[model samples]
Target: MMRKTLTYFLTLFLVIACSTVPITERKRVNIVDDAEILPASFAQYDTFLKENKLSTNKEKTQEIREIGQRISKSVDRFMRANGMIEEANQYKWEFNLVEDEQMNAWCLPGGKVVFYTGILPVCANEDGIAAVMGHEIAHAFAKHGQERMTSSYGQQLGGVAVALGTSGQDYETQVLWNSIYGISSQVGMLAYSRTHEKEADKLGMVFMIMAGYDPEESIDLWKRMKADSKGGAPPEFLSTHPSHDTRIADLQRYLPVARMNAREYGIDE
Candidate 1:
């Protein structure tokens, strides 16, 4: 049994050890799905919506869908022009409005999008809606989910490797895998999650601009977010996002470039 388990572990290790990001050059944001994570993501989103009461703000909720559709569709066009249409169509593309009084929004692995009722006050208008939607859509387009999954697989494989290396050992490997595998495979090692958050901020601004929201608004949004941070949030180092300072700076840096792209591809409103 040990031999069999060891063989299995070795095979898993081989797969993960060999897995790497082939596109060394940072490519334009796009998702490539292999495990059909999108469908599961869509299903999970549906379940959440069914269980939660959606907002009765008929006009506002309709506006969310309108803005989400516009941004999502525009993002698709942008991706296609950039040579990644395949990645954009991976989602079924549904937007929902939840009745919660929290300024929150997210897009799932697929195109499942949700806007919380409370956020409307902050989002303030269609452009603000577009800003938030652009950020969420950017997270999906960048394949953040797959990146996280690949990271996880690496750690599991690493733990199994350590176990196999240990001559006649089980407890140590199991404990180590549980404790460190997740940490070890992180892309940035010391501050991997921050890297992802920053990437999302950059790419999100690109999409917001492409979808007709002024990229400059993103800077203000981050400022608002920074103020919100003081109210309460997970510490900067521990969360998947970096500090608002980093996000604000990145958004500012990307504004000019995003505006140029928008000028080339999008219609002025």
Candidate 2:
């Protein structure tokens, strides 16, 4: 009992210690870490790219790079203006378009991004791609990875408590701890993904405007996504993100703010 109690407090402390303190008030946006988390993330993203088939279309690949650079620059400007220049400097953004048909794209910590080729038709143009890129890149800015790690650490401590409370011997306790860590890590991944999607929706709008693309495009893109779904997503709450309906509606609500931000940047929306 004593051991479990102590473990819980320790884990709680780690979560607090590692959590990102937003530059403003009580977390208009929650953030995570790049400096502490990126090394592992980079290696993993690199390996995934190496193992997966890559797009051979020269022009298409070139286009992804160009768009990524333009959007990244815009995000840099916004960050600098907000006194987050130091945070922006931590990014070493790179874009790669892969030849997968999953209609998926993701950005890793420290600005490593990948686009699956299957979604090109959905993207449709430079502006369309900007919508997706802004959202994915926004995940990094929100520090979802660090948030996940911090949350996982807390869960891990809970597992340690279980092991300590129930396991009578050293070997049994060790086994229980390992199992706890494994299961909790998987759960943490799913929860963090939802947070990332929301973060992207917010920050990505900011990026698109800064990059000379209209943030309202995000609403149109999500509308297309729902049409592509043809129906509703099945239990996305358990897997990747919110339901398609939920995402599209949220986009609708935020479009006005995004549009207003673009006007501030002199990008006529």
Candidate 3:
């Protein structure tokens, strides 16, 4: 009876929570509320800015901000056109450049973005920056973080369901079931993260192109990323991100589609 009830509730929850991602139209189950997560995200972003040193190079910092503004405005236009104005308005978009030596950049929910100085060289130029910027913004735009939190909660609930379902089983059988669940859940999450990464890549290219940036630069950017890694990246099956080689190939294949979609929006460039 408990198992049946759990199954019924889980199905109901999934049905209620399902949503389609913008651009990609992929269906996802996200139980986390923007109202619940955005305030915390804003607070954390504030704390991070207060703790980090802003870049001293005025020219580069201004460049990053300019590119961010263009890309973000394009994204805003897209959301509003698609009748996602409320979601678009919720974004308090801000971009920053930090004085750090890590080739990293990220966007927190609600459109807070940061770029480390070390990545500038990898970015190589304005086009490169747009490639990275669009990708990071896509993460926020898609609400990947919130989706991940929802998935984590689902995993915990699944664990509880497993415990309840196995209460009648012998100790050894329960242990085996849990062991299988643990391994499978971890791998499942890694795969989920990779999917998010790829989706971001595709969405980013479209956003960049819509903003009149070259979508093909994204391919070159990934090629540089591949060369920079020097073959040290983990195997794709075990990593949270697709391998650089995989990304470069994927970008190549998707460029034509991205350009076509951009043209539909009247972006001839």
Candidate 4:
């Protein structure tokens, strides 16, 4: 009975979970839709703002807003030109500078963005900020977060299958199978995260160039990011994010293609 249940869910997953990413056309396994996720995301964003302090640095705050607006406009143009107008319209487009020292930034679904002060020195200037924001925005544009959730559910379902399949086994054997499932699922999740990060880098660079930022600046931004990490990051296989060197190299390789994409929007590098 458990085997039959597993087969049914697996079949349904195969049937309904395939989606193509907008810009890159990369196929992803994601069953969740925007309508299902955005309401919760917006609420979460509002709650985050209420709970955290907004940055008081007027100059830096203005810079973040300006850069975000430019990239948001460019992203709109790209989506419209590519027949994603409905998707573009769904974005509310808010940018905020939060008072935090972590070198981090993220764009929630529906285009809510928050940047930390600690990342500012690394950004160095408006173009550098664009580089960072562009990458972060691309994560939203690509719906990587929703894909990640769907993947997590898929992994959890695998765990259920293991539990059910081993119901008749000795305790030690079930423990062994569960352990194997846990490790394999974690590794798969890490791989999915790394792929999303790399794709975001490529799409972000293109978006930044389309918004009139220098594509070459993205490599510099990643170099700063690497230097900022100080070689203290976890090894690539176990980490959700790629190593700084890997990201820098990927950005360098994608530069020409990003420039070509920018030209399609009438922005030449």
Candidate 5:
């Protein structure tokens, strides 16, 4: 049973894994497509806006929109120039500032973005905002969320396989195997998530540079983020995110590469 299950999953993985991200070119499962996902994403975005308080500070709200627009335009231009016009066209960009104080922001697939006022202070100015927004947009642009969904699906399939393989085993043996499988699967997922975060950081820096923002601001932003954490975080290997130190160092190391890539787009900074 284990052999048969493994064979089946391997075949399925081979058949469906084809999509490659734009900048990173990382191979990913094509199990989910934009057409099938965008309607739901858009609906959820609308519902979220309806449920949340939109910021009343007109000046701040305008600034959020302006930063978002500039970053989105830069992304679109880069994608179009790189033979990804169809992918770029699929994005319907919308950015809003919410009144929450959670110091959080996210970009939903298909280019819907929400910035909490709480994070604005962390993103102190236009360049800082570019750093944050660029990172969020990078996650969407690289289709990391879609890849995560695919990975979750694969994990579920793995669980199912384990169940089938252990069906004939003793109760104690079954429990042990199941526990091991669950732990390994969780660890794999966490590793996958960390990789995605690192990829976003790199791509975000590139986008920010191309958008005419200083890539160095990325390091500064992460430093601010680390200070905000108050030195409290799980070890890097155990967390879904790299340690703040790791992120800062990575951004500092990659800033030069990002700037060099920007030159290709005629953005020499």
Candidate 6:
């Protein structure tokens, strides 16, 4: 009876928390409140800036900031046009270039963006930078962090449910169940991350196109990334992101749709 009650409430909670992502319209569960998460994200971002070295290359820094501004403006336009005024107002967009050697970049919630210098060579050009920038921004635009937090909570609740359901089992059986649950939940989270990556890829293409970037450049960027990997990347099923080949193919397939959507938005470039 207790197990059934827990299950019932869990389902109810999930249903109430369900929402759809903008543009892609994919259903997501996000129980974490923006009011609760945004301030924390901003504070963390401030701390990160204090701990990290900002790039000294004025040229590269200006370029990143310009691209970020263009893309963010496009995003804001889209949101406001689609009746997302409140959401648009929530973002305090800022971009920075960090003096790091890692080929990495990320966007925190509320649009705090960082670009590592090592990624510039891989970007190869403005279009490539836009590709990476759009992708990272899409993660924040999609509220993936908040969704992930909600997913963690759900996983913990599932652990509780597993414990309750196995209370009558022998110790050995209980141990086995828990081990299985742990492995499965970890894998599930990885899969969830992959989903977010794919969604971000698609959404990024659209945003880049809207910002007058060449969508085809995204495919080329992935190809370059694949070459840089030299075949050392983990298998797709085991990784938190899609493989490079998969991303390249996805961008290729998504290019026409992205361009069409941008045209519809009156962005003809």
lDDT (Cα atoms) of all candidates against the true structure: 0.69, 0.74, 0.93, 0.88, 0.86, 0.93
Candidate 1 residue-wise lDDT, 133-173, digit = tens: 88787767666666666555555656666666564667876
lDDT of 4 by residue, 1-269 (tens): 76998889798896788878875779988888889999899999999999999999998899899999999898888788879999998888899999999989999988999999989999998889999999889999999888888888888788888989999999999999999998988888898899999999999998898888887888998898888778899989999999999998988888888887778665623
Error of 5 at 110 (Å): 0.5
- RMSD to truth, every model: 4.8, 4.7, 1.1, 1.7, 1.8, 1.0
Q: After superposition, how far is residue 80 of candidate 4 from its true place, in Å?
A: 1.8
Candidate 6 on 1-269: residue-level lDDT in tens? 99999999999989999999987889999999889999999999999999999999999999999999999999999888989899999999999999999999999888999999999999999999999999999999999999999999999999999999899999999999999999999999999999999999999999999998988989999999999999999989999999999999888888888887787765624
Model 6, residue 112: C-alpha shift (Å): 0.4
Clashes of each: 0, 1, 0, 0, 0, 0
Evaluated against the true structure, the overall lDDT of model 4 is: 0.88
lDDT of 2 at 227: 89
Better of 3 and 4 by TM-score: 3
Where does candidate 4 stray beyond 4 Å?
265-269
Return the clash pairs for model 3, or none.
none
**Against the true structure, whose lDDT is highest?**
6
Q: Give candidate 5's whole-model lDDT.
A: 0.86
Which of the two, 3 or 4, has more lDDT?
3
TM-scores for every candidate against the unseen true structure: 0.77, 0.78, 0.98, 0.94, 0.94, 0.98
Sort the predicted structures by lDDT, highest score first.
Answer: 6, 3, 4, 5, 2, 1
Expressed as tens digits, the lDDT of each residue in 149-224 for candidate 5 is 8788778877887887888999999999999998998888899989889988998888888888877888898899
What pairs collide in candidate 1? none
Model 2 spans with C-alpha error above 4 angstroms: 1-15, 18-33, 161-192, 261-269
List model 3 lDDT by residue over 1-269, tens digit each: 98999999999989999999977889999999889999999999999999999999999999999999999999998888889999999999998999999999999999999999999998998999999999999999999999999999999999989899889999999999999999999999999999999999999999999888988888999888889989999989999999998999999999988988777755523
Residue 162, model 6: lDDT of: 93
Cα lDDT tens digits for candidate 2, 1-269: 68957867785575556434232112422234466677888888889988998899999999999989888877667677778878888888899999988999988888899999988888887888999998888777667666666666566566666666666768866776777777767766786677667667866876787677866777778778878888757677476687777777887787777766656654422
